[model samples]
Target: MKLHALSPLERQDLIKQYAKSFSERAKQHDEEQSFPFENIEELKMIGYTSLSLPKTLGGQGIPLTEWLKLQELIATADGSTSLSIGWHMGIVSELNQKNWPDSVLTHVTKKISQNGFLLNTAATEPDTGSPTRGGKPTTQAKKVGSDWVLSGRKSFTSMVPALDFILVSASMDDDQVGYFLIEKGASGVRVEETWNTIAMRGTASHDLILENVKIPHDHLVELVVPGKKSPSGWLLHIPACYLGIAQAAQTEAVSFASTYSPNSLPGPIKDIPAVQSKIGENEADLIQARYLLYGVSAKWDAATDEERLEMQSELGVAKYHVVNAAQKIVDRAMRVVGAQSLFTSNPLQRYYRDVRAGLHNPPMDDRTLVLLAQSLFN
Candidate 1:
C-alpha cells in the first residue's frame, strides 16, 4: 500500500482508467446536478479515492506529486466531479501530514477506502466573506463535558448531498477558532436547498445548519492558529480544476471545427488559419500553466518550512498566471466555436461559466498582484 508498492507506470494506468469513467458520467452529472455515484464506486473499487492514505493504514500511499497529476487527469475529464473529490483527497493528504493518532488515521482511511467517503470544508460564511480576512466564525462550538455542541449556519458547503463528513470551522467563546468533524446523521444538522449557482452546480454546494449539534471530543481538529500560511501546493488545485475546464472547452472547440463548415468557407472550420491559431494559443497557455504548477510543486515538496513560507509570493504568481491564462484560453475556445458556444446545450457555455469561477477562488487577482508587488518592492 506504500507509494513504493506501486510502480510509476501502474499509477499512471490507474489514473487513466479513472479518467475514462469520469468522462462517461460527466455530462449526466452536470445536467442533473447529481452526484457521480457510479464514478465514486469505480474509484473505490480501484482504490483511487484512498491513494493519499498511508500504506500502513491499508490504503495506497501515493506521493503528492503523483496525486496531483492524477487529479489533473480526472478534472480534465470532469471538473465538477474532480473539484468535489479533490477537497476530500486534500483533507486526507493534510491529515496524513499532520501524523494523527494511528487509530484515528486507520479508522478514517479504512472507511474511505471501503465505502469511498467524501469530506469537505465549511469555512466560508456569508457575512464574513473571504476566509483570508480571518473571518470571525458565526458558528460556535461549546464544550459540553465529553462532547461539543455546535450551532450556526455554514454556506457554500460543497458536495453536501454526498459528503460523509464536514470539517466545520467554529468559534469557541465566540472568538477562538476551531474545526470539528460533523457527520451527516448528527442531530440538529440540516442541509438547506440553497445551491443555485452559475457554475460547478453539480457540486451541490448547499448550506449546512447546525442547531445544537453534538460532536465527540475526538472529532475535533485543533489548530494552533485561525488561519495559518497555506502551502503553495494547495493553490495548484485551483489551477488544476480550471485547466481541466479549459481543456474541455478546447475539446469542444476542436470537435466543432472539425465538422462545422460555413457557407463562406471552402473546407471544414479546422482548415481555417484563424481557428487553428486560437487552438494553438490555448494549447500553449495550458502547457505553460502545467509547467509552472509542476515546477512550483516540486520546489514545495523539497522546501523547508521557512523556505516554504517565504515562497508565498511565488504561489500567488502561479495561481495568477494559470487561472487567468486558463480563463482566456477557454474564452478563445468559445470564440473559435462561434455563437453556438453560447447555447445552453453546448458544453462550451458551461466551460465558459465554470472557468470564470476560478477567478473568484482564493488568491484572487487583486490579492495575488498585491502579494507579488510587495515581494518585488519590499
Candidate 2:
C-alpha cells in the first residue's frame, strides 16, 4: 500500500508499470496532436505528482538520482508526456529546496498531492525567444487596488490547455520582472491553439494570452534579481527526460535487430557484427549519458551551499552532453534500423524527431559551450 520508502528498483518498477500504457498510446496522441490527459491521470493516481515533495508534506520525496531514472523510464514510454509533466516535477522540487515563501510552496504541494494539479511556467514571448536569454518579458503586470492586472502573451506554453497552475512572467510597472501564478478559469485568460510542429506534437504547447487578468498581490511568486539567480535542481529534469527518450529509442533498435531478418541473410541482423556494432555503439553512449546524468544529480543532491555555488556551468554541461548524446543514440538506432526507420508508423522515426527537440530546450548547446569556456577562467 505504501509507495515511498521503497527500494529504488521497486519505485522504478512501479513507475514503469504506468509507462507501458503511455507507450501504447504514444502514436495515437502524436498523430492527433492531443494531450495525453489519461497518462497524466495514471501518474497522478500513482502519486507521481508528489514524488519530489518532502515526506513531511505527505509526498514521496524521492532523491534526484531515483527521480531522474524514473523520468528516463517514463520518457522511454512517452517523451511528450514526460516533457509536459517535467515542468511540474522540477518546479515543485526546486521550490522545496529554496528558502522562498511558503505561500507558493504550500499552495502548490497541497494542490498537487491532494488534487492532482499540474504546473507549468510560461515565460517565452514571440519576440524574445527563450526566457533564459535574459530579456525582460513584454507581458506587463500593473498594480491595482490590492491586485495585479497581468497582460501578456506567452508563446510555447507547454501543456497549455491542461495546466492547473500557469506561472506567467511579467514586467511590473516598477521595472521589476516576476512570475505570477494564474489558476485555471481565471478571468481574461485564454489559450490560443498554435502548437503545430514537426516534433513533440502531443505536448499541447500553445500560446497563452492574458488580457487584463487580475490576481491577488501575493500571486507574484518571485522577482528576478540580476547577478543573484539561484542554482536549481529542477532544471536537471529536462536532461533526464531526454535521456529517457533516447533509452526508448535504444530499446526499439535492439528489439528490431533481434527480430527482423532479411530473406538473403541466414538469420536476424542482430547476429551480424555490423548490426551488433551499431547497437553496441548506442549502448555504450547510452551508458555514458545515463551515468553522467546520475552522477551529476547525485553530486548535486549532496552538495552544500559552498559546493552548489560552483555548479553553475557543471549543470549546463550535464544538460548539453546528455541531450547531445541522447540525440546521437537515437540517430545510431535509426542507422541500425536502416531506411525503415523513416516509416511513419515506426517508433524509431518518432524517436528521432522527439529526441531532436532536446537540442532546443533550455541551456542550448551554444550557451553550454560558452558557460564551459567561462568556467575555465573563473
Q: Looking at model 2, which ten-residue stretch has the lowest summed lDDT?
A: 225-234
How do the residues 1-378 of candidate 2 rate in per-residue lDDT, one tens digit apiece? 234556778888888788889999999998898999999888887778888877666577788777877888888989999898888887776665554467866887788878778888898999779877787899999999999999889998998878889889889888898888899999999999999997899899999999999999888877884234666766888899888888888888999999999999999999999888888888899888878888888988899978987777778889999999988899989999899999989988888888889989988889879878876788
Give candidate 2 regions above 4 Å deviation: 56-58, 97-104, 226-228
The digit string of per-residue lDDT tens for model 1 on 1-378 reads: 322346877777767767887877777777777767776666666667778766666557566667777777777777787777777876776565654445555666678767777677898888877676667788888989998999998888877888887889888974678778777798998999798777877777888988999977877766535546565465577777787788878888888999998899898999989999999998999889989988887787788878987777777788788889988998999999889888877878878877788887877889878767877797
**lDDT of all the models against the reference?**
0.77, 0.85
Runs in model 1 lying further than 4 Å from the true structure: 1-6, 56-58, 99-103
Q: How many backbone clashes does candidate 1 have?
A: 0
RMSD of each: 2.6, 1.7
TM-score for each model: 0.91, 0.95
Q: Report the number of the highest-lDDT candidate.
A: 2
Q: How much is the lDDT of residue 191 in candidate 2?
A: 92
